[model samples]
Every structure is written in C-alpha cells, then in structure tokens.
Target: MSARETFTDRWMTAMSHAHRLLLKASRGQLGATLGPMKVVELHTIGRRSGKMRSAMLSAPIVEDGRYILIASKGGDDRDPFWFSNLVANPDVELTVGGVTLLMRARVADAEEKAALWPRVTAAYGGYSRYQEKTARDIPVVICEPR
Candidate 1:
C-alpha cells in the first residue's frame, strides 16, 4: 500500500483506487510512478533467520544512483521489520520495473542524512510526520547500485 493508503486507513476504497492507478500507469507492471521516487522490490535476509524477506517500497533517488529509504514502518513506535534484517545483511536485490539489480545498503550517516532527508521528505511528505511520532531518529538507508 502507498503511504497515504495504510492498512488501517479509514478509506479502503481510496487505497484500492491508488493501487489500481499505479498499476495502470505502470501498465500492470512496476516502476510507473510520478518521479524521483520509484517502486522497488527489496529482498533481504532475515536478521534472526537466514530466510529471505521481501517488500515493495518507494525510495527516493539521491546522488550517485543511490536511493534513500526510511524505516518508518508507517510511524509505528518500532522500526520496520526489515530494518534489522538489513543491518544484519546489507546486501540486497532490488527489482525496479523489469530490471533486477544488486544494491549495497548502508544506513546514512549524520551528514548524509542531513542532505538526503529533505529529498526524501519532499517526495513523500508523510516521512516528516513519521519522524515526529517517534523518539528515535528514523534511519535512512542508502542503496547503491552494484
């Protein structure tokens, strides 16, 4: 679901509508978004177990063909389920549209965070609000194409 269309959202139809809209723009495929941010399927090894975990997320493109993703988990008090998995294993596969690629992942540092967060928040405004609800700083993971 998109940021505006959470599982707990009041308007279920709105969420469905959005998913449909995206699918159509994508021609029933992936990577069909407005701009800067693209939908990518990320596969990461589980932190506790070695099993693979997957999720589709929109990450903003930053410098050097890298992407910035937040572990907001829809503003939950805890980090996203995938966050620790990435920490334990930063190497990941990204399926963007029809292209499957490898991306080395690392949580952005203070300077990088300062530079990238605004770009991310601009693409998805909810991220700023997500930060406001949590005490811990939200992490921005950079996925560099490899």
Candidate 2:
C-alpha cells in the first residue's frame, strides 16, 4: 500500500474501534446515528481465519427494510476486508438502533447500483468524492433480513 493508503487504513481502524467503544460505553444510547445515516454493526465470518469479525459502518440508504452500505474503503483501490468477508459468507448479523437481526448481504447488481447511486451520493456527497479518488468501482452492498 502507498503511504497515504496505509494511513487511511490505520485511521479507519482506529475510528471503528472508537465508535464501537462509544456504543458500548453508552449502552447503545449514543453512536447509533451519524448525520443523515444510520450506524450499524455488521458481523461476518472471517473468510480465512474462520472467526467472527465485525465492522461499524453507516447505512447511506435504508429502503423497504433493507440497509444499503457502501464498500468505498475511503475510495481505496482494493476492496475493504469486511467486504471480502461478506462475499465469502453472506450470512451476517446487523445491529442497528440497539436491535440486532440476522441478515444476508449481497453486492448490488449493476442495475441496482445505477438506480441507487444517485440517492447514495445525494445522502452523502463524500461518497461521490470517494468514488472519484479510485479507479475500481466501489461496491454497493445490501443487507436484508434473513
């Protein structure tokens, strides 16, 4: 990884840790929402280690009981680790607003992405900027109740 990418990864790791701590410290009262997005704790089985892993992510779009997540990784060229994990094992657990539910995750197909991209960028323009920073097409993930 380039120096900038390495730094970004480290920063993201730290922020996720802090976010989880905040949620735990507040007993799910705080860190549940961020700006216009809802924060969710996504748990997936590690692809290589065969262990459970989790990440704190924001749901940019929630429609028809489905949560849409962006696998931007701050616009990194490589896919995020969490994204790979979910691809290997779609069965996941999502915790939102102190409610935990079993969910299945899948990458949105091209047609779905085309329709949702505008809404996602509108919800957070930063996502547009993130897309511009990388050559790879960032994936849009959908998590639905299982």
Against the unseen true structure, what C-alpha lDDT does each candidate score?
A: 0.74, 0.93
Query: CA lDDT of 34 in candidate 2?
Result: 85
* lDDT for each residue of candidate 1 in 45-117, tens digit (9 for 90 to 100): 9988899876666786645677677887767666666778888899988766657778888998999899888
C-alpha positional error of residue 134 in candidate 2 after TM-score superposition, expressed in Å: 0.3
Choose the strongest candidate by lDDT: 2
In model 2, the runs with Cα more than 4 Å from the true position are 1-3
Pairs that collide, model 1: none
Q: Measured by TM-score, how close is model 1 to the native structure? A: 0.76
Model 2 over residues 1-146: C-alpha lDDT tens digits? 78987898888889999999999999988988888999999999999999999899999999788999999998888898899999999999998877888999999999999999999998899999999999999999999988
Lowest lDDT 10-residue stretch of candidate 1 = 7-16
| lDDT, model 1, position 111 | 98
Top of the candidates by TM-score: 2
